[model samples]
Target: MLAFGCTWLYDGAMSRSDRFEIFLAAPPGLEEVLTDEAREMGFGPVTAVPGGAGLTGQWTDVWRANLELRGAGRVLARIGSFRALHLAQLDKRARKFDWAAYLRPDVPLRIEATCRKSKIYHAGAATERIARAITETLGAPIAEDATLRLMARIEDDLVTFSLDTSGEPLHRRGYKEAVGKAPMRETLGALFLRQCGYDGAEPVLDPMCGSGTFVIEAAEIAVGLPPGRARRFAFEDLAGFDAEAWQAMQTPRPPRDTPLRFYGSDRDAGAVRMAGANAARAGVAALTKFTCQSVSALTRPEGAPGLVMVNPPYGARIGNRKLLFGLYAALGEVLRREMRGWRVGLVTSDGGLARATGLPFLPPGPPVAHGGLKVTLWRTGPL
Candidate 1:
């Protein structure tokens, strides 16, 4: 809920000498989008890894990442890594590890562990060993409901420890309390926007705006707002956190604006109303418009050609998925007839639903997980 001045944060950026590994998580298929965003936000040198991007920076960098990056699901600070052949070795190394470097002795920590191709194959036991180390040596208590979580990952006998700096996933944004079934995660929506080549200069229209995530995100992008500006992060509880420095880093900037407006249309009237309310909560209401209307009734507003991104129902769970193809085709017919010159980004778990749209789409992006379904972003050039 606070901000820092650009100067103060950048100074911290240059001031840190002890750089730790910072990993920014993204949806599986959208790692590249997060990588691009990380570089654009000045986190470098960044390497695009399998699940996210890896970079090295000081604790200040860790806080800034949790504050600024819109595309990352979570920001993890890789505290340290070591080799451990078994549980006793892990316990010995963990006991010696400098937990004070990141965790505060007074703060409770929740530990999560994962093991793969490692001699210490029991992840739960590994977690308990690390938890005991922190408790017995560092004096921090283990708690089931702790706000701060430490992740212990043992892969191929290498025990790597990381702190979940972002607390709740970044996409929660602490503002969107109103979401319909299959609500697109704000982080996922932001990545999809990037994949669609939206730089926030263009107007965006989400035809099936269940909770208006796409429209709100587009407006936020256009206005240069920090997605985490309204939320608290786990990093605030770490030993390295500086309240003054962080506040300075979060210094408020004048809200940026664009002349172009983003729009969303949904047939569910209550959803339309909720989206509008959510937009106001996010401080993007002035630049965004939500309406209760069917896709068949969608019309292009008076403006330059932009992008029309949609996340329509594909019946992945309960409904007759076959019938949804006709809906896709109808929505495509609407865009094809009404929205010439505007690019399209459609999210659906079913490729057939995408193909049914009949819009001239390029190959889809990689499959991304959404509400237990694997979906991809299908794109098109200016239609």
Candidate 2:
């Protein structure tokens, strides 16, 4: 027999009256960074928790969050919760809850359940009861391949449900179909740029420029382009989705006028080509320049000094460990000699490698888990 779990219950069309708790997922150790972004984007009264940030908002906020926020992995809307000390109690409560209010009878449903320190300890049994209740009561079909996902967590005799409002992770910003080795995620790139005090008023340079993630992100921010503009979200599939309102909300912000052009350089011709193509797809081609050149050949662009950001090979995943020291030292020497007034933000897993740069980095930010390695952002004032 298939076990089941339940999702959110809403009264009707999502409106201001349908206020709920929203969770914005983030990378571990970067919760505070995401919080700052949410607050700046006008999303809170926000609070940072272990995995992400939380805020109380209505359905419009959820739509705006999916449309605008650049740092969240996905948005989860808390539906409701109840106490179910045992499987029987869970079955009864799930059946009686108003599943039909939010879930459509025709749309297939998928549920994930977790249990911790609860008398209804068997997650499978709890899931089965809830699933049965929804299927029997609401007549919604259950399918593993369903795009709409509901999460039910049972902790300390309390079962809380949340609906995943974003389908794909926000990092897949629907652009940059091409990526190089160990490319930085677009979400992390945005938050890191924020951490480095980049506000899109100045140019950005990435010497390694793996697929031009940082350069494109900076250009998009400068032009006031919403990150989710190119993609569809899971929220569109939910009941009460206002298609007209969402379309009106996405009316493009007027492109800002800036004289600066973002820059990226790589020794690999293929990487340079890939980065250029990605920038074009992201609609920032005119504001970005990619060149095939090594770090040794990198030069300060012809403009006011700006931020120099790079996520180079961490040796754990990309290059030889011992030889990377020379690369970092050489990068440090180049920046110190040529880029006198520029600020720098370097992301790497090794403190020693960061030290090898010999730049006057103030201090390292919190470690961020990326691709099985804990990476930290090392920043410096004007060089």
Candidate 3:
């Protein structure tokens, strides 16, 4: 599987403006949605791959993606690649790699490796080789707990090196200090909202909102707030990061004066309180409203009809499987009876539970991995 005459090696003298491959890690089943976002955001030559979206961009594009894109779960910068059939070959080539070009010698790094369809079968041994090479050749210390990670993927006898530009998963979003059980991730919520045709122009409501993810995300989008504005990234520790430029690029955009309001309601008063606190931390409390109420009490907010997005309790994660059917039926009945012109997007793992809602759902979207179960987004036309 080795390509004997081809090599993509990093040059230490390459400037930040030089173009290279950047991969935006996508949540399972959400690659297309992310690709569309990257295209709309003007990332060039974007393509949807198996697990992520691939694009060619400069360092600034990397920074902008980490700062702006909502659907991307993480960003990886693919610096270079080489052919290595075995451990000794990997060691030989890795020791000669230009690690100093991107990584700071004073900063600690963690190496992770994956092996597939290659002779270098031991991921641990491969990681040890790469780590030792970086330490001996470039003086970078390897650490287990370091936020900056260098990922090595050995597939088809090719060793490709990528830096995890995002230290933590993008879902953290830095504002959610409190989360309820089975909370939906902000990244996944954003993608679902995109699939539902939400463009920040209309109001949003979540009946089973946990931690107010949907409500806060919708509000932030409406107000033109970037998702990564409240957080730090691993790219700041790279060798060539420009703090002044990054700060300048992120000069806060005055939130547009959106008259729209986002809403979340939950039966658990504690969840409601947590959602409010999270909204406050995200700087969107003024645009969001949270309440403690059951699904039966859900009423249409006074405004133009918008999307009603919900992630209800599924049997696998929440409570008794048999009892959730009644809950689903009740939710369906309420939307049909009360929400006459609003569209509905329901996320659940059990098709039976989704069907129990009795909503005239269009075809379901791809199954997404959530809380260890595959959940599908079920959508319906205006009810």
lDDT of each: 0.85, 0.87, 0.90
Per-residue lDDT of candidate 1, residues 1-383 (tens digit): 00111111111112235666778888777777899999999989887887888887888788888888889888887666678999999998888887776778999999999998999999889988989998999899899899899988787787777788888889999889898877889999999999999998999999999999999999999999889999999989987678999999899788875898999999999999899999999999999988888899989889799999998888875368988878988999999999999999998888988999899989778998888889988999999
TM-score of 1: 0.93
TM-score: model 2 vs. ground truth: 0.94
List the candidates' TM-scores in order.
Answer: 0.93, 0.94, 0.96
Task: Report each candidate's C-alpha RMSD, comma-separated, in the order given.
Answer: 5.4, 3.6, 2.4
What's the residue-level lDDT of 375 in candidate 3?
A: 96
Q: Among these predicted structures, which one has the highest lDDT?
A: 3
Candidate 3, superposed: residue stretches over 4 Å from native: 1-14
Model 3 RMSD, rounded to 1 decimal: 2.4
Tens-place lDDT digits, model 2, residues 1-383:
10123334433334436667888998888888889999999998998888888888888898899888988888998877788888888998888877765677788888889999999888888778888998999899988888888888888787887888887889999988999899999999998999999999999999999899999999999988999999998878776678899999998878888888999999999999999999888888999999999999988889799999999897897889899999999999999988999999999999999999999999799999999999999999999
Prediction 1 global C-alpha lDDT? 0.85
Candidate with maximal TM-score: 3
> How good is model 3 by TM-score?
0.96
